[model samples]
Target: MAAQASGDLSLVGISKEFETFTAVHPLDLEVPAGSFFALLGPSGCGKTTTLRMVAGLEEPTTGKILIGDQDITDTKAFRRNVNTVFQSYALFPHMTVLENVAFGLKRRGDKDAVAKAKESLELVQLGAVAKKKPAQLSGGMQQRVALARAIVNRPDVLLLDEPLGALDLKLRRQMQIELKRIQSEVGLTFIHVTHDQEEAMTMADSIAVMNAGRIEQQGDPASLYEHPKSVFVANFLGQSNLLRASIEGPGAEGTVMVSSHGQRLEADASHIPEGAREIWLGVRPEKLRLGEGGGPNRLHGVVADASFTGVATQYLVRLPWDQEITVVQQNDGSARALEGENVTVSWASHHGFVLDAAEPADAGLGHEDG
Candidate 1:
């Protein structure tokens, strides 16, 4: 883990409440200097609230906010060296792009506000539209203007609350690359909040998955997806097929035998509890291999449905236990499985992960359907 001491921003035991409702529970997070970190969750998970607190738009009910080792828990929004780009872009309707970008500097009475704004506009490749009003620009262009406005001040931290939410999918993806390039050039800490898992995974150096006003797990995108700590994180971060299993006995090489729906399998016990009686085995859809001739962890299933997604083909397999498992295969221009065909689903023991027994009863598995 990267040390928090090296970060430009740190939140320690932060919490926020509104009257009878707790908007955010105690949360601790660190944003490494010059790193792009994402706070990802579903709606009402308090990601936006956390960002607001960091931007000084909301006061925390408890805990300290630090910027480069200095406590700024009580600092006013303007006094703290942080800027935010809101979801709506929030540009002044009457102001031209140039004036909007220069607004913050003008408030600070900076003599070079206009020059700085022009330079920032150039940075976002929007210099040609500097004199145009917000209404005159396309949604993507308006978003760029908003970004230029935020970065013109060169704040220590830039908080982006779903700045791409309003854009169409294709434009959003294009902006994702642009945002990453800008972050690299500025070398400033970026704390972006969004409920879009794909966006977070595409842009963030690390991500914190939040749920129900609390952070369920935090890690690099790969780790979080491959080894989710709880059921919520597993399901929310990406699609996962979880199997309920009970430990049968010890096996070779620190592996354990488990039984699921009358099928016996072996899996690595390195991360599971020593005396784990029950466990949820989680495997990504793409990890499962089709056909027979699997090494150790293999099962037979009938293909229920298959869909071609251009780049990949997704298979819905039905197991003997009446559970449906999803499997995805890259489209390599080769013959693939057909619907209603019997195939064996297999994955290496090391390719999957097992949650500890101490986790919630529903951990590592979503709601089971009848």
Candidate 2:
């Protein structure tokens, strides 16, 4: 299969409502042509519903769907240039891999269906299994067949709705890389909807974090992880430690000063959200260094727990206010903190972001990583 280009995808004011509840609210989004975009959120956050609306599988309550300059809102699911791959591969169990991949082309009476299917299988690196039935393949190979089938159709947009959900941990991680590689090689517009934070981060050029039928934030992986805009995004996208604080005023060199339990601290002004009646200092576990008096922003705490996970050591540090904060340190021969040891946690002010204290502190806890 030669590399093919796709039109940019657009969703304008799209919403889906049932009798009692709205699965998705009015939403406006644009995906650049051939970009790997992810709709990421926990269950019931509307990511899947929004993907379904685009696939024309579910009628939208309002708004239009477009590709480039063309409107496709009312087009039939089969008529529109879109293909979907679900968690279930749904490959014909009794048919050969090539036959299954060529099913759609053959149904449409395309003369070169068999030839095209061969190329598609090769693109997914499964040409050798073209003659084998799906039952004769492993789970990962079965998944590649599903991908080859979808790519053979050459749709303007490919919608993946938790397609890797059934794979085990190691396989899922490996497939994440393969999926990204395939998308890049084909240069097709790929819209992936998944609940796994790491999967989205690993494969997507951009990600929209959804919460309660609304897009909380959308940006590149690093921006979302380093500078989340809300409590939900900060908590949901990854683990974070939020400290109760009050804005004291400005600090030296364009920094925002805050007071936590009468202790002064500094953070980059951009990290602090505006009009914050109440405040919480946001920091990532990896950004914190276990030590005393090392950074412009420092806190005194006692080591509550330490866990070594090969690559790094994670610690639970308890502050004087009785709040426990998480810290992660690279296991690079640095002194490790032991349990019940008094210590200070430090980080550069620029590494921290602030969020309004009004939102639920534990907003995104207990989400399934599938």
* Deviation (Å) of 295 in candidate 1: 4.5
- What C-alpha lDDT, on a 0 to 100 scale, does residue 340 get in candidate 1? 93
Q: Report the error of model 1 at residue 266, Å.
A: 2.2
- Alpha-carbon shift of residue 185 in model 1 (angstroms): 1.0
Tens digits of lDDT, candidate 2, 129-236 = 899999999899999899999999988899999999999999999999999999998888899999999999999999999988999999999999998888889988
- In order, candidate lDDTs are 0.86, 0.91
Q: Which regions of candidate 1 fall more than 4 Å away from where they truly are?
A: 1-7, 273-275, 293-295, 356-370
What TM-score does prediction 2 earn? 0.98
Question: Cα lDDT of model 2 overall?
Answer: 0.91
What lDDT does candidate 2 reach at residue 172? 98
- Model 1: ten consecutive residues of lowest lDDT: 361-370
Against the hidden reference, what TM-scores do the models get? Answer: 0.92, 0.98
What C-alpha lDDT, on a 0 to 100 scale, does residue 273 get in candidate 2? 74
